[model samples]
Target: MKTRIQELRKQHKLSQEELALAVGVTRQTITSLEVEKYTASLVLAYKIAKYFDLTIEDVFDFSELEEI
Candidate 1:
Protein backbone atom coordinates (compact mmCIF):
# COMPACT_ATOMS: atom_id res chain seq x y z
CA MET A 1 0.00 0.00 0.00
CA LYS A 2 1.08 3.54 -0.65
CA THR A 3 0.95 5.94 2.27
CA ARG A 4 1.63 9.62 2.90
CA ILE A 5 3.34 8.80 6.21
CA GLN A 6 6.77 10.06 5.18
CA GLU A 7 5.30 13.23 3.75
CA LEU A 8 3.18 13.80 6.82
CA ARG A 9 6.11 13.13 9.13
CA LYS A 10 8.28 15.59 7.26
CA GLN A 11 5.53 18.17 7.25
CA HIS A 12 5.02 17.68 11.00
CA LYS A 13 8.74 17.61 11.71
CA LEU A 14 8.45 14.20 13.33
CA SER A 15 11.24 11.66 13.12
CA GLN A 16 10.40 8.01 12.61
CA GLU A 17 11.30 7.23 16.19
CA GLU A 18 9.09 10.01 17.45
CA LEU A 19 6.16 8.96 15.36
CA ALA A 20 6.64 5.35 16.39
CA LEU A 21 6.64 6.37 20.02
CA ALA A 22 3.49 8.41 19.56
CA VAL A 23 1.74 5.58 17.78
CA GLY A 24 3.12 2.91 20.10
CA VAL A 25 5.22 1.08 17.56
CA THR A 26 8.88 0.51 16.93
CA ARG A 27 11.01 2.75 14.76
CA GLN A 28 11.56 -0.23 12.50
CA THR A 29 7.82 -0.56 12.11
CA ILE A 30 7.60 3.04 11.00
CA THR A 31 10.39 2.39 8.53
CA SER A 32 8.57 -0.67 7.25
CA LEU A 33 5.35 1.26 6.82
CA GLU A 34 7.15 4.02 4.94
CA VAL A 35 8.88 1.53 2.68
CA GLU A 36 5.80 -0.68 2.10
CA LYS A 37 7.60 -3.70 3.49
CA TYR A 38 4.71 -4.38 5.85
CA THR A 39 1.07 -3.56 6.12
CA ALA A 40 -0.32 -1.99 9.28
CA SER A 41 -3.00 -3.49 11.44
CA LEU A 42 -6.28 -1.62 11.59
CA VAL A 43 -5.50 -0.37 15.06
CA LEU A 44 -2.08 0.85 14.00
CA ALA A 45 -3.54 2.54 10.94
CA TYR A 46 -6.15 4.25 13.09
CA LYS A 47 -3.51 5.39 15.54
CA ILE A 48 -1.27 6.70 12.80
CA ALA A 49 -4.12 8.52 11.10
CA LYS A 50 -5.34 9.97 14.35
CA TYR A 51 -1.85 11.11 15.18
CA PHE A 52 -1.82 13.22 12.01
CA ASP A 53 -5.38 14.42 12.51
CA LEU A 54 -6.35 12.71 9.28
CA THR A 55 -8.66 9.90 8.35
CA ILE A 56 -7.12 6.64 7.27
CA GLU A 57 -8.09 7.38 3.69
CA ASP A 58 -6.03 10.52 3.80
CA VAL A 59 -3.00 8.70 5.11
CA PHE A 60 -3.29 5.51 3.09
CA ASP A 61 -3.99 4.89 -0.58
CA PHE A 62 -6.73 2.38 -1.25
CA SER A 63 -7.26 3.11 -4.94
CA GLU A 64 -5.49 -0.05 -6.06
CA LEU A 65 -7.53 -2.14 -3.68
CA GLU A 66 -10.69 -0.44 -4.83
CA GLU A 67 -10.14 -1.85 -8.30
CA ILE A 68 -10.46 -5.31 -6.87
Candidate 2:
Protein backbone atom coordinates (compact mmCIF):
# COMPACT_ATOMS: atom_id res chain seq x y z
CA MET A 1 0.00 0.00 0.00
CA LYS A 2 1.20 3.45 -0.85
CA THR A 3 0.93 6.10 1.86
CA ARG A 4 1.38 9.82 2.25
CA ILE A 5 2.86 9.26 5.70
CA GLN A 6 6.32 10.44 4.68
CA GLU A 7 4.86 13.51 3.05
CA LEU A 8 2.71 14.28 6.05
CA ARG A 9 5.63 13.80 8.42
CA LYS A 10 7.77 16.12 6.38
CA GLN A 11 5.06 18.75 6.21
CA HIS A 12 4.59 18.51 9.94
CA LYS A 13 8.35 18.44 10.51
CA LEU A 14 8.10 15.29 12.55
CA SER A 15 10.74 12.61 12.70
CA GLN A 16 9.77 8.95 12.48
CA GLU A 17 10.48 8.54 16.18
CA GLU A 18 8.30 11.52 17.02
CA LEU A 19 5.43 10.30 14.96
CA ALA A 20 5.83 6.80 16.38
CA LEU A 21 5.81 8.16 19.88
CA ALA A 22 2.69 10.16 19.20
CA VAL A 23 0.96 7.18 17.68
CA GLY A 24 2.20 4.60 20.16
CA VAL A 25 4.25 2.50 17.82
CA THR A 26 7.91 1.82 17.23
CA ARG A 27 9.91 3.99 14.85
CA GLN A 28 10.51 0.87 12.81
CA THR A 29 6.76 0.44 12.42
CA ILE A 30 6.44 3.97 11.15
CA THR A 31 9.30 3.35 8.73
CA SER A 32 7.66 0.15 7.56
CA LEU A 33 4.44 2.04 6.90
CA GLU A 34 6.24 4.78 5.00
CA VAL A 35 7.96 2.16 2.87
CA GLU A 36 4.76 0.19 2.32
CA LYS A 37 6.33 -2.87 3.92
CA TYR A 38 3.53 -3.13 6.45
CA THR A 39 -0.20 -2.77 6.51
CA ALA A 40 -1.39 -1.40 9.81
CA SER A 41 -3.83 -3.23 12.01
CA LEU A 42 -7.17 -1.49 12.61
CA VAL A 43 -6.17 -0.15 16.01
CA LEU A 44 -2.82 1.08 14.77
CA ALA A 45 -4.37 2.65 11.70
CA TYR A 46 -6.94 4.47 13.83
CA LYS A 47 -4.26 5.73 16.15
CA ILE A 48 -2.16 7.01 13.28
CA ALA A 49 -5.06 8.74 11.57
CA LYS A 50 -6.19 10.32 14.79
CA TYR A 51 -2.72 11.62 15.48
CA PHE A 52 -2.84 13.42 12.14
CA ASP A 53 -6.40 14.57 12.79
CA LEU A 54 -7.56 12.74 9.70
CA THR A 55 -10.01 9.96 9.12
CA ILE A 56 -8.78 6.50 8.18
CA GLU A 57 -9.65 7.04 4.54
CA ASP A 58 -7.82 10.32 4.56
CA VAL A 59 -4.68 8.73 5.97
CA PHE A 60 -4.97 5.42 4.15
CA ASP A 61 -5.80 4.59 0.56
CA PHE A 62 -8.32 1.81 0.23
CA SER A 63 -8.68 2.17 -3.53
CA GLU A 64 -6.05 -0.43 -4.36
CA LEU A 65 -7.66 -2.97 -2.11
CA GLU A 66 -11.01 -2.21 -3.68
CA GLU A 67 -9.62 -2.99 -7.13
CA ILE A 68 -8.81 -6.47 -5.93
Candidate 3:
Protein backbone atom coordinates (compact mmCIF):
# COMPACT_ATOMS: atom_id res chain seq x y z
CA MET A 1 0.00 0.00 0.00
CA LYS A 2 1.07 3.58 -0.64
CA THR A 3 0.40 6.55 1.62
CA ARG A 4 0.68 10.32 1.53
CA ILE A 5 2.12 10.35 5.07
CA GLN A 6 5.33 12.08 4.17
CA GLU A 7 3.58 14.74 2.18
CA LEU A 8 1.09 15.37 4.95
CA ARG A 9 3.77 15.51 7.63
CA LYS A 10 5.68 18.07 5.60
CA GLN A 11 2.55 20.08 5.02
CA HIS A 12 1.95 20.15 8.76
CA LYS A 13 5.61 20.87 9.53
CA LEU A 14 5.68 17.99 11.97
CA SER A 15 8.57 15.65 12.62
CA GLN A 16 8.00 11.94 12.52
CA GLU A 17 8.37 11.77 16.30
CA GLU A 18 5.82 14.52 16.72
CA LEU A 19 3.30 12.82 14.49
CA ALA A 20 3.91 9.52 16.22
CA LEU A 21 3.33 11.14 19.59
CA ALA A 22 0.13 12.73 18.40
CA VAL A 23 -1.10 9.40 17.07
CA GLY A 24 0.14 7.35 20.05
CA VAL A 25 2.81 5.34 18.27
CA THR A 26 6.57 5.24 18.12
CA ARG A 27 8.74 7.23 15.78
CA GLN A 28 9.87 4.02 14.14
CA THR A 29 6.27 3.17 13.44
CA ILE A 30 5.79 6.49 11.71
CA THR A 31 8.93 5.91 9.71
CA SER A 32 7.70 2.49 8.71
CA LEU A 33 4.32 3.87 7.65
CA GLU A 34 5.92 6.64 5.63
CA VAL A 35 8.06 4.14 3.75
CA GLU A 36 5.24 1.65 3.26
CA LYS A 37 7.12 -0.93 5.28
CA TYR A 38 4.28 -1.44 7.73
CA THR A 39 0.55 -1.84 7.51
CA ALA A 40 -1.26 -0.26 10.41
CA SER A 41 -4.00 -1.98 12.33
CA LEU A 42 -7.50 -0.59 11.85
CA VAL A 43 -7.36 1.27 15.16
CA LEU A 44 -3.97 2.75 14.48
CA ALA A 45 -5.03 3.84 11.01
CA TYR A 46 -8.09 5.51 12.45
CA LYS A 47 -6.03 7.31 15.08
CA ILE A 48 -3.68 8.63 12.43
CA ALA A 49 -6.44 9.78 10.12
CA LYS A 50 -8.29 11.43 12.97
CA TYR A 51 -5.16 13.26 14.05
CA PHE A 52 -4.97 14.80 10.62
CA ASP A 53 -8.69 15.41 10.39
CA LEU A 54 -8.84 13.09 7.39
CA THR A 55 -10.47 9.85 6.52
CA ILE A 56 -8.42 6.64 6.18
CA GLU A 57 -9.01 6.69 2.41
CA ASP A 58 -7.62 10.20 2.22
CA VAL A 59 -4.34 9.13 3.76
CA PHE A 60 -3.82 5.61 2.47
CA ASP A 61 -4.80 4.27 -0.96
CA PHE A 62 -5.31 0.62 -1.76
CA SER A 63 -7.32 1.05 -4.96
CA GLU A 64 -4.33 -0.07 -7.00
CA LEU A 65 -4.88 -3.58 -5.71
CA GLU A 66 -8.63 -3.59 -6.28
CA GLU A 67 -8.33 -5.80 -9.34
CA ILE A 68 -6.47 -8.43 -7.42
Candidate 4:
Protein backbone atom coordinates (compact mmCIF):
# COMPACT_ATOMS: atom_id res chain seq x y z
CA MET A 1 0.00 0.00 0.00
CA LYS A 2 1.15 3.51 -0.78
CA THR A 3 0.83 6.16 1.91
CA ARG A 4 1.26 9.90 2.21
CA ILE A 5 2.72 9.49 5.70
CA GLN A 6 6.02 11.19 4.92
CA GLU A 7 4.31 14.06 3.19
CA LEU A 8 1.78 14.58 5.93
CA ARG A 9 4.41 14.22 8.62
CA LYS A 10 6.56 16.87 6.98
CA GLN A 11 3.61 19.17 6.47
CA HIS A 12 2.78 18.81 10.15
CA LYS A 13 6.44 19.34 11.10
CA LEU A 14 6.53 16.02 12.87
CA SER A 15 9.37 13.56 12.96
CA GLN A 16 8.77 9.85 12.47
CA GLU A 17 9.31 9.32 16.17
CA GLU A 18 6.81 12.04 17.04
CA LEU A 19 4.19 10.65 14.75
CA ALA A 20 4.81 7.17 16.12
CA LEU A 21 4.46 8.50 19.62
CA ALA A 22 1.24 10.26 18.80
CA VAL A 23 -0.16 7.21 17.12
CA GLY A 24 1.11 4.70 19.69
CA VAL A 25 3.44 2.80 17.43
CA THR A 26 7.18 2.33 17.13
CA ARG A 27 9.45 4.49 15.01
CA GLN A 28 10.25 1.40 12.96
CA THR A 29 6.54 0.89 12.34
CA ILE A 30 6.19 4.44 11.08
CA THR A 31 9.27 3.95 8.93
CA SER A 32 7.83 0.74 7.55
CA LEU A 33 4.59 2.53 6.70
CA GLU A 34 6.46 5.34 4.99
CA VAL A 35 8.31 2.84 2.82
CA GLU A 36 5.19 0.78 2.12
CA LYS A 37 6.85 -2.26 3.68
CA TYR A 38 3.88 -2.62 6.01
CA THR A 39 0.18 -2.33 5.46
CA ALA A 40 -1.81 -1.09 8.41
CA SER A 41 -4.76 -2.88 9.88
CA LEU A 42 -8.18 -1.18 9.93
CA VAL A 43 -7.81 0.05 13.50
CA LEU A 44 -4.27 1.27 13.01
CA ALA A 45 -5.20 3.00 9.79
CA TYR A 46 -8.07 4.71 11.56
CA LYS A 47 -5.77 5.87 14.33
CA ILE A 48 -3.19 7.23 11.91
CA ALA A 49 -5.71 9.02 9.76
CA LYS A 50 -7.43 10.49 12.78
CA TYR A 51 -4.10 11.65 14.17
CA PHE A 52 -3.57 13.60 10.96
CA ASP A 53 -7.14 14.87 11.07
CA LEU A 54 -7.66 13.16 7.74
CA THR A 55 -9.75 10.31 6.50
CA ILE A 56 -8.11 6.96 5.89
CA GLU A 57 -8.48 7.39 2.14
CA ASP A 58 -6.67 10.70 2.40
CA VAL A 59 -3.65 9.05 4.01
CA PHE A 60 -3.70 5.77 2.09
CA ASP A 61 -4.07 5.27 -1.64
CA PHE A 62 -6.32 2.31 -2.21
CA SER A 63 -7.50 3.06 -5.72
CA GLU A 64 -5.01 0.61 -7.22
CA LEU A 65 -6.18 -2.33 -5.20
CA GLU A 66 -8.88 -4.65 -6.43
CA GLU A 67 -11.96 -5.16 -4.30
CA ILE A 68 -11.76 -8.16 -2.06
Query: lDDT: which candidate is best?
Result: 1
The lowest-lDDT stretch of 10 consecutive residues in candidate 1 is: 59-68
lDDT of 2 by residue, 3-63 (tens): 7889889999999999999988899999999999999999998988888898989888899
What are the per-residue Cα lDDT tens digits for candidate 3 across 1-68?
A: 88888999999999999999998999999999999999988899899888889999999998987979
Give the poorly placed runs of model 1, Cα more than 4 Å off. Answer: none
Candidate 3 residue spans exceeding 4 A from truth = none
Best by TM-score: 1
Candidate 2 error regions (>4 Å): none
What is the overall TM-score of model 2 with all chains considered together? Answer: 0.93
Error of 2 at 47 (Å): 0.7
lDDT of 4: 0.95
lDDT value for candidate 2? 0.91
Per-residue lDDT, model 2, residue 58, is: 87
**Residue 16 miss distance in model 2 (angstroms):** 0.1
The lDDT ranking, best first, is 1, 4, 3, 2
TM-score, model 1 to reference = 0.98
Judge candidate 4 at residue 13 and give its lDDT: 96
Q: Each candidate's TM vs. the true structure? A: 0.98, 0.93, 0.93, 0.93
Among all windows of 10 consecutive residues in model 4, the one with the lowest summed lDDT is 59-68
lDDT of 1 by residue, 1-68 (tens): 99999999999999999999999999999999999999999999999999999999999999999999
